[model samples]
Target: MTDQPPTLPTSMRAGRILGPGHTVVVDVPVPTPGPGDVLIEVARAGICGTDLHILDGDYELARFPMTPGHEFAGVVVALGEGVRRSALGQRVTADPNLPCGLCPECQRGRANQCHDLAVVGVTRDGAFAPYVVVPERVVVPIGELSFAAGALVEPLACVVWGLERVRVRAGDHALVFGAGPMGCLLIQALKASGAARVAVVDLAPSRLALARSLGADLAVTPDELAALADVAPLGFELVVEATGVPSVLEGAVEHARPGGTVWVFGVAAGDAMARISPYTLFRRDLALMGTFAVNQTVPQAVALIQGGAVDVEPLVSHVLPIDAFAEGLRLAAHDPTRMKIQFSFGDASS
Candidate 1:
C-alpha cells in the first residue's frame, strides 16, 4: 500500500476576509511547513492601523481574502528539513517582510527596498490563524519575553529603523506628531536616544496621557500646538511625524526649527501626498527624510526590550482571543482609549 501523507491539523480557526470589502471568522487548513520554513503556533498578534487599512481596501498592495495580521509572536512547533538553526518550542517573533536576498536592493544591503517584498498578512496569509508558516530567516528568537511583548518586536523594529535614520542627538528637542502606539513608541525611542525633551500631539486625550506616561515631556492636542509655538517660535529641533495624515506632515514642516530635521515615519495611504512650501524648504535649510520598514533593527529592538531599556507592557492596552480579531480591529480603529490591541491564542494557557 502507498504511504499516506502525514496527518496535520485538518482545520484551523482564523479570521478570514470574505471579499475585498468584508471580513469574518472562519475555519481554514493549517499550513504545512516546507523546506527552509518554520511553522509557528501564534500566541499573540498585534493589531495595527495598517491592518485596518487592509480591511478597508485602503492599502493598495493588499490581497483580498487574506488573513490579516503581521505583527506577531509565537512558539516554533515545527521546522522543515535543513532548518537546524532554530529548535522547536522556542519563543520567537516574526519579521513580516520577506525579501529575496538575491534582489538588487537586497544585494546592496537595502533589504527593505527589495523589489519582491512579500509582507505576511498583506501579500499572503499571515498570523491571524493559530498557525503560520514563515521562512527561517525572518524568525527571530525572543528567548523568555512574553508573547504580547514579543509581538511588538516587529513594530518596534520599524521604529528603531526610523530612529536610526533620523539620527537623533542628545539634548535635542523633538516634536512627535501623534500619540498613538507608534507615536508613543517613538517618544520612548527618542528619549532613549538622548533627546532632552519630547513633545507629542494628538487629538485623543487618553493617548496623550499614555504618551506622557511613556516619556513624552509634553502632550498637546492639535489646537494646542499653536499655543505651544508661542513657547518655541521656531518650533522644535527635530520633528517626527507619526501621524500618516498629509496635513500633519505639512504641520510638521511648519513646526520644525530652521535647520532642523523632520523624519516622516508614518505610512500614509498609497495616493496620499503631503504638500510643502518649496521656498520654505530652501530658506529654512530643513532636512526632510522618510523611513520605510526595518532593514536591520530587529535585534536592537529585541535587545532594548530584553535589557529593560524600553517598556512594551504599558503600550499593550488590550489582549483578546483570535476569534475576536474583528473586535480588536474595531477597537484599534475606533477606540481612542486603546493603544495596542493584541490577539491571544487559547485561554491564556498556551
Candidate 2:
C-alpha cells in the first residue's frame, strides 16, 4: 500500500543557478513523480565539489536555471504509477547517476561512463529544494540512518567503487593525499579492507587531526611527509590523490613503490592538465587508474555504514537551511575550515 502525507504543497522554494556564478532562491512548482518514480521530501543535501564546478560553469553537463544537489537523503512521501519497489515514508538515499542502459559503456557493465547520462542534479532539478523526483530503481532504503549520515553515502560509494577497481594487497601500506572528507573515508575503508597502515597528508592541521581520529595510522602536513619513510622505506604500495589539485597528482607518482598503484579518485576540472612521467610508470611497474562516480555499489556503501565499518557523520562540519544557500555556497567554496556543507530541510519551509 502506498502511504503518503495527508497534504502536499503545490509550490516550494528552490535553489536555482540561472547562469555561471549566479544563484537565486525562487518559488517553483512542486514536482510530481512520473511512472516508476517517487517524490522525496529531502531531509538533508550536501554540497559537493562537483556542485562548485557547476556554479563556475566548469561542468559541461550542468543545465542552467537548474538546481544543483545530488548527495542527499530524504523520505519517500509519494509514489508514482508502477513504483511498487519504494514505499511512502521510506528513508532513502539515491544513486544520482542515471545511465542509459543502451549505451556501449553500460552494456559492458561500466555504466558510470554512459555516453548519454542524465544525472539527478546535473541534468535535472535536484534536492537543493525540499522535494525531488527520483526513479525508484536508484533509491536505496537507508533504514534508521541519520539523514546527515545518509547524505554521505554517495561519497562513500565513490570510494567503494574505487576499492573494487584497484587491487589492495593484504597488509599493504597506503598513502592518501588530502585529509578532507573523501580522504578520511579512504583511510577507514582501507583499514577495514586489511591494509596494515594508512597515512594521510593535508596542508590543514585540523583536517589531519580528524584523519588521525578516523583510524589513520599517521596524519601529517605536507612538510612532515619525511616521517612516512620510517613506515614505508621503499615507498607506499598504494597512493591515492583525493585533493583534485593537479600539482598534488603530478607529485603522487613519486611516492608509489615499485609495482605500487596510484588511484586518481578526485574530480579535477575537465580542462585541467597534469604532467607525469610515463617512463617512471613503466620502470616501476606501477598501475594508474581513475574511478568515476558510484556504479551499482549503493548497497555496499549502505552496508558499510550500517555495519559500523566506516563512520561518516563525523565528517560533516557545516549545516544550514535552504534560505542561507548563498552563504553556504560562499563557505563551501572559500571556507578553509569547512569539511562538508549540508542544507537541512525540516518541512520545505523558508
Global lDDT of each model?
A: 0.84, 0.91
Candidate 1 lDDT trough over 10 residues, lowest sum: 1-10
Per-candidate TM-score against the hidden true structure: 0.94, 0.97
Q: Write the per-residue lDDT of candidate 1 for residues 223-278, one digit (tens) a residue.
A: 88766665466578899888789999997888888888989888788889878998
Off by over 4 Å in 2: 1-6, 347-350
lDDT of 2 at 158: 94
Task: Mark the regions of model 1 whose C-alpha exceeds 4 Å error after superposition.
Answer: 1-8, 226-234, 347-350
Best by TM-score: 2
Our tally of clashes for model 1 stands at 0
Q: Give the clashing pairs for model 1.
A: none
